[model samples]
Target chain A: MPRVVVDVVLKPEISDPQGQAVLGALGRLGHRGVTGVRQGKHFVLDVEGTPDEAELREIAENLLANPVIEDVELHLSGD
Target chain B: MRIGVVTFPGSLDDVDAARAVRLAGGEVVPLWHADAELPAVDAVVLPGGFSYGDYLRAGAIAARQPLMRAVVDRAHAGMPVLGICNGFQVLCEAGLLPGALTRNSHLHFRNRDQALRVERADTAWTSSYAQGQTITVPVKNGEGRYVAADADLDRIEGEGRVVVRYAGGNPNGSSRDIAGVTSADGRVVGLMPHPEHAVEELTGPSVDGLGFFTSVLQGALSA
Candidate 1:
């Protein structure tokens, strides 16, 4: 069996308020040395056989991330 | 004139949109998300709601529905389409319109009476409004911030595709204070404000929103 992992994140220019909020909370909790923070989505997919790279890329591009404001990266691993 | 209002599983404003059409002297036709066939209607309105539970992304799931494919084809063929709130998200996701609606910068679910200035009046859904006319409508959303690449924004702005802009203050931090926009042919329009919710003075802040519904009906009359 194989697994595909997709990580989706907003473009660098796009602001991530959720990440900012988390950063603020970290500061309040006395955690230091953090320059900045950003948040995103991670999706894990399981397959019965070898995953087709093109199909996984298509799914990540069209469904997991919108190209307008977000970028996606896909990784495959075997169980 | 006959107008169709699409009702997705989580749609909350379809009834109000249909009522606005009837009040504007047009017939109302209910369209469902699963149905690919659209009835004989002069125009279509995609009302607001959290369709598909806003899963994966706002309007992303609903944008791929069977009916939206037909709507996209019709929109390209010059049929008038008005997308409000979530519907606006759907239009962007479906590629019927440009840009994408993202999470609000302020991180709040804002609901209020918003003021907007009509930027273009020749569009099918804005013909009733005068250029520069200011109107108030209800805007309620959690993810309504409009964003696009710099080049795309410049292109759309250069083409005068912007239909309306925020008048008093920026509500959701949309780029250039844009409240709404239209397709190149000016037939397909999408906005964050709830025009259908503001069509009746008795229930809404004012009757200013009626013009959106009436504008299409008037266009049908002349076409």
Candidate 2:
């Protein structure tokens, strides 16, 4: 099995609306001092069979990350 | 044509998306977030809804789902994929599309019939319409703001990747008023509006959204 690790990150300086809303709700609930929050996701895939890394990279590039706003880091585990 | 609509646990628009696909004359295959197969569908739709209950982030949790792996594979093979609303969030989160869907400038959840100009109708999912065509579709979301750096924004605009722009008003303060965009090859599209809800006249603000589904079907058949 080939393991693929994906790290998703938001662009710096982009305001996270969901994070802001949570911060506001937390403040209203009397929990202050939350400075800043940005949210993203990570995925680890263990493919059952070996696939071409170039093809997989194409997948990551086209369907995994939007090149305009998000950055994607791809790592292949277990050669 | 067989179109797959993925349903994450918290997804609210999968059924509607399937219905739209069926109405557009394609067989609908319901896909689950945990699945690893794409069900042999010619195209896929990552439907709207608060996937993973908007945990961590709006589309962040759902973006890591197992089915997304298969979607990534098929989409790379040039399978047509469309992301709507929260699905759009997942696309960005999954790194399929560019730009993040943040909160509205007014910081409110907005639900309204929005007018959008089809800026580029050459994409696989939008070729049925003409460029500069104005269509009304329902837009509903809290995190709908779209932003990118000036350079990337210029490149996206200059490369003709922008598919739709808010026509009447800047609903969510999206940079360049962009509401939707297509991939470089035009096979994958991500948009913030709820087009599935507008596929039928009786159930929607306009039947204009039928073109999106039909366009994909037509494109697939022609290809």
TM-score of each: 0.97, 0.78
Instruction: Provide per-model DockQ scores.
Output: 0.71, 0.28
Error of 1 at B53 (Å): 1.1
**Prediction 1 global C-alpha lDDT:** 0.91
lDDT of 1 at A79: 21
Candidate 2 per-residue lDDT over residues A9-79, each given as its tens digit: 66775656667777788889888788766666677777767857887778676555555566777788732
Best by lDDT: 1
For residue B133, model 1's alpha carbon misses the true position, in angstroms, by 0.4
TM-score of chain B of 1: 0.98
Q: In model 2, what lDDT does residue B89 have?
A: 88
Q: lDDT per residue, candidate 2, B29-117, as tens digits? A: 88889987667888889999998778656787788788997897778889999999988888778777776777687787889999999
Candidate 2 scores an iRMS of 4.4
